[model samples]
Target: MDLHYEVLGQGKPIVMIHGGGADSRDWPYLAPLLAKHYKVITFDSRGCGQSPSQTEAANYIMDVLNLLNHLSIEKTVIIGHSIGGQIATEFALSYPQYLQELVLVAPALAGFVHSLDLLESFQAIQSAAPDVSKMTELVVNSPFCSVIKDSTHSKLMRVMTEHNIRKMFEWAAFGAVWPKPPAIERLHEISTRTLFIRGTRDHEDSVKIETHFRAVPNIQFVAVAGGDHMLNLTHPEELYMNIVTFLGEPNKQA
Candidate 1:
């Protein structure tokens, strides 16, 4: 298949979507813990990890839909990080009937325009381009990610970042297609039981997005103390605990 995925454990299903510049490998530390309590599914989105690149326009929300249908997962919790969180948000908005809960960790807003400074920083990273090491350094060494720079997960983060950068060189003609009207303006429309998470050391722009998400009618927000954008790697135990608490009773398949 074009998307490489794996399922573990046995309980209510939870589909974990990794952020940009990462793949299912992003969930190694946290996935196992979650697997102990729920059926966990992790996958490499197109062009990341083992997934093949696509030449046509891609709708990640649809990708999530197709994955669920292929697995015969009629209902599942969606936990998404970074860009993956953005996809999860749109998915919840589009198909609330299919999700038991929605969790977003530092997700990007579909219609949001980042500040000029952040845009420039991203551009600078892109300018490094073919220099994979430099681009990876720019991403990992940034303030929002620096907490992991000295942690044991640093090596893994570097590897994932570099692998993601290299994958860009292999991209075919592909354009991401997000649903219209943007999730930012439609936050009030989402009625799913939602959990929003972010780290204390997260970027300023992420804070702005949180303000928009407050419009979500039924949502809870948690700030991981001393956590960074990559809290999943640096604070998996804490992350898992918060999730389980939010999930409450273990899901049962009747």
Candidate 2:
């Protein structure tokens, strides 16, 4: 599938992958800033935004690989948020030769087991089969919404969440089969330079994911003081600076 994507600027390539409930629009605030220094590619993952939905579970890694191959991009930096981060990690493991570096923002790791209560709560939400309004409200109240101080960005997030909630559910129904074999045990296999960024206000799972990545030889972890899961929207400047600094490091050269 030729997923929807847009590329901007001119320089070394940098691919930005949005979170589970978001699309390419999620990077609007940050992409242009990064574009000043590098080519930025943003895309809607399978079943999100402008991309066609699939009846079967989507292989995010393959979808990303397909996109890169379609553009004839052999190697580039991969920046991903939430589940997107999980995809980046898998790509680094499965196709390390194709990555220059990996940047994960409040990433979700495979096999980081959720509590039974949390699982039950998600099941309940799934059972309720929320309408867009209900899902928007739930998302607004979730940790993902915390620490978002900008009203305009917050509204944009709500709108995007409502727009993509149905597809999110559709993907969920297909089951959580992504990042197969789990990434926790495969961290050491990732040789690509990596940067893991977590917000202080983000969920505990992000912290756990960061902890596991510590064992990876080429990984660097940074915590944003008051940032949250949506740092690309809420703290784009800070995130951009961190990314730019990492990309500029002498050791990160392709």
Cα distance off (Å), candidate 1, residue 89: 0.3
* lDDT of each residue in 148-183, candidate 1, tens digit only: 887889899999989978987888766798888999
lDDT of 2 by residue, 1-254 (tens): 46999999878899999997789988988999988878889999888898887667678888899999998999899999988998898889899889988999888888778656546656655565666687676666665557763445788888887888866666634644565578988888889999999888876666867888897898888899888778788888889999989899423442
Worst 10 contiguous positions by lDDT, candidate 1:
245-254
Clashing pairs in 1: none
Q: Best candidate, TM-score-wise?
A: 1
Query: With candidate 2 superimposed using the best TM-score fit, by how many Å does residue 34's alpha carbon deviate from the native?
Result: 0.6
Top lDDT prediction, candidate number: 1
What would the TM-scores of all predictions be?
0.96, 0.91
lDDT of 2 at 116: 67
RMSD list, candidates in order: 1.4, 2.6
Q: What 10-residue stretch in candidate 2 is worst by lDDT? A: 171-180
